[model samples]
Target: MQREPLVLESAAGPHTIINSKEVVNFASANYLGFIGHEQLLNSCTSALEKYGVGSCGPRGFYGTIDVHLDCEARIAKFLGTPDSILYSYGLSTMFSAIPCFSKKGDIIVVDEGVHWGIQNGLYLSRSTVVYFKHNDMESLQNTLEKITSENKRIKKVRRYIVAEAVYQNSGQIAPLDEIIKLKEKYRFRVLLDESNSFGVLGSSGRGLTEYCGVPVEKVDLITASMGHALATEGGFCTGSARFIDHQRLSSSGYVFSASLPPYLASAAITAIDVLEKNPDLISKLKENIAKLWTGLSDIQGLSIASTPESPIVYLRLETSTGSVKDDLKLLEDIADHALKEDSVFVVVSKRSTLDKCRLPIGIRLFVSAAHSESDLLKACESLKRAAKIVLVNHI
Candidate 1:
């Protein structure tokens, strides 16, 4: 059966107001405008017409299509790893991997502010859990040293370190280089969820490993969400042939869930090619990020969250809830002036909890290869205006 397309009425480079009867949305993960790219559209359309809508069974079953296999193989090469496996979603690949290799007495060392997927996985795993400070290498090393110092008692059990290349919320990147160094010293396995970094970093866009000049061959495990950077649906886990083999055999998410759609696989591969051909888009994205960072720093009103080197940049909105409920509306109001009134577009981050109002939190300014210098300046201008309107008038 074919899937229903959510027609947007229209879309251009990076700005799609989604003015359909459907909904105006900022909840999208299409960071680089990959979905509307003609290359991806044509390739995925061809695959859909050729392969149908969805896989009928799991990959281990009768669901392995030639296109799917090719996509998986090519992803490994693209990421500089020997092997890769696809999952229906990124969180599934990441969460399921943690528990697959660990068991009781084994310890899962995690960053305190890791994505909820890691936190939840540790809760479900039989392994004892240890959480160090977010992106604090010394904290990670201290935890490792404390555990391994009692080597004889801990000999039967093992430890694994898990973190993301870029945090989804605050956009702060993890210190993988130092973590890798600690792995060598402490004998801990590492899993890096490259969800927020892939297709948005490095010359080849292989993610943080490449950005940091680390060899993928040395990293034991890697996982990523395709939805964001790839402008497609699904996720993937990549590593050595042996590790992938074990994951395929052991990961429940891979075994039980329906495999990713063939069209998505085809589109993802083509999307990677587009990224490779246009290295400058990646560079431009960085420029936008840098501009946003610099602009925010110069502003005396707001506090930028942990400075981001990636596409997702956030700041701490200093207004109270009495000032605004669902900052999305304030952002939407700003977007109207920016997009509607002034013909500019920006995605304003939303706040779900009450404490989120002034709890050292703020907006996530997303930039893509599709945005222009004028667009970024416009967004910054709008953000500053909105912040003042809400903060000064205490709206």
Candidate 2:
């Protein structure tokens, strides 16, 4: 029997209404608890009254508003970058920004576990793409060395190393310090995607560079989706003035797509304000992450795959079922049982047909600052029970 998709009847937050019942939400990436913030709402309302929703044209063609420039400047200042360019949509940022710099003859060494947006960008760029083992610094070093030794035109061809701050599929944090060391040694420009890390990591919410104690200027480019932590509807790329200026004229998404709604741009600016004023929100989020991680430490037949610092708590099976479909079914059953029987909303890591992720399937729990200790406890107990019921039956 086919199952109906669960409909959210309320705003996505620590607790959400679904099927007429409120459930502890572990599926949303509202990491800083910014979704539906009062201040953000007010800002959006003000911008809406002034600008009325859409920008009505591409950024190049009268769609650029004061709020857009303000939002871009705000992001750049927050990240300590020289400049930034904003995109109408979060997912479009990766696909557009990547191909803008890399071209057919360039070489891009990428992590295999990056999201589909990056994969599509690499495909579109028509660059000679090489894959390194996900988050394996040694493998990346080896790949770079191999490329340098084999290609006589290595110095002539543009070289780039692309990786995510926090992998979406695995929830593992990349070793940015090590990656920086390697990029310098190999003479490759670094392009980091902080979609899941921005406003979530670091004491001040400056993302991976701050978390790793590396200077932000060391990385050539950084891209992030504001939807996760900002609770807004767009994305931005931050870098040197040269990179931002080049993208302004050539990036397909920025050049052709309609500008981000003025209200959303305002919301993003207000979100940054909220983040800066309340640094304690990041600390609170870390506390919740620790509580959830400790609670889920001893589940049977599964192991936590995410790092202790990551807001995303991923639980993968200790052993695969010898088939991807079977493993996914087990995970789905566990998630469904948790929702139906325990009233805790969780999600299975289901991959698209186009996704080439080789990582193990798992159940992902997105922890939030808004989650109370009781919420974490309830989710832990419910998932433990669900995993036992589902895994025991499957065996």
Candidate 3:
């Protein structure tokens, strides 16, 4: 039987109220624990009072608020990019930014493990899309070589290599250093989605480029959703000033959609300020992730799929049940048992029907700086018990 969607009765954080019971939350991507942060709340309130609730028009019209420009500039400065453009919605950032520069007859080499937002963007670009093996630099090189050799007009048409810094589906960090070398060798522009890694990976929370020690200018385009690390509602694309200027005029989402609310923009700006002031937040988050990984090391019939540096700790069955549906069901049962019986909230990798990626299904536990060692221990113990109960019968 299909279960009804779980409803939250309180604000999402390290702990949340669900069905009148408080549980340790591992379902949200609140990496910095900024959901109800006092500073961000105060910023939102001040902006709300000053600018009202809405922008009332698209950015091209009278909707370009001062806070939006400040947020964009702040992001550019944070990432060391020449400029950046903001979008009202997070998911739309990928779809709009991808198709903005890539048009028909262009070539795009992408990772198969990228999220649905990027998949949709590639489809909309009308470009010839090619998929390399997920995170396999050798496969990327081979694919790029094949494309270069096979297509005689490749030099004439625009070519882009798109990937996610930390894949949402598998929680794997991309080999960005190797990717940058390949892009330079093949003369391809790189469009990286840093939604999952922006504030989580780097030493100073500047995303993949900083994490990999690659200069910010190495990437041609970089986009990230503030929803993940910043705990804000919109997204931004950062790169050269010329590229941003072009996106302002051509990107569908930025050109046609309403400007992001002033409060959200203010919240994003404040989030950055908070992140910069307190670099220790990243350290605390890393420590929490380490504690969770250590606790989950012995989970029965399951294995960790995420990298040590990743906040998204993905748990997959040690052996597949041979069917995606069956595997998903088992994972869901474990998640449900952990939530209902043990008061630990977790989630399965529930893919959209529209998503055509071939990655395996698993359970994803989003770790946060706010999660205490005790909270992680509780989650680990609960998951272990739930997994044994769910998998024993199947075995």
Worst 10 residues of 3 by lDDT: 147-156
Local accuracy of candidate 1 as per-residue lDDT tens digits, 215-328: 887689988988888888888889988888998889888988999999999998898888878887777777777876777675434667754676777666544354455554
Residue range 1-395, candidate 2, lDDT tens digits? 34566899999998999999999999999999998799999999999999998989999999999999999999999989999999999999999999999999999999998989999999999999999998999999999999988886556788999999999999999999999999999889999999999999999999999999999999999999989999998899999999999999999999999999999999999999999999999999999999999999999988999999998999999999999999989999999999999899999888778887778889999889999999999999999999899999988
User: Whole-model lDDT, candidate 1?
Assistant: 0.74
Clash count for each candidate, listed in order shown: 2, 0, 0
Q: Candidate 3 clashing pairs?
A: none
Residue 338, candidate 1: Cα error in Å is 6.6
- Comparison by lDDT, 1 against 3, better one: 3
**How close is every model to the real structure, measured as TM-score?**
0.86, 0.99, 0.99
Q: lDDT per model, in order?
A: 0.74, 0.93, 0.94
For candidate 2, the per-residue lDDT at 312 reads 91
RMSD of each: 4.8, 1.0, 0.9
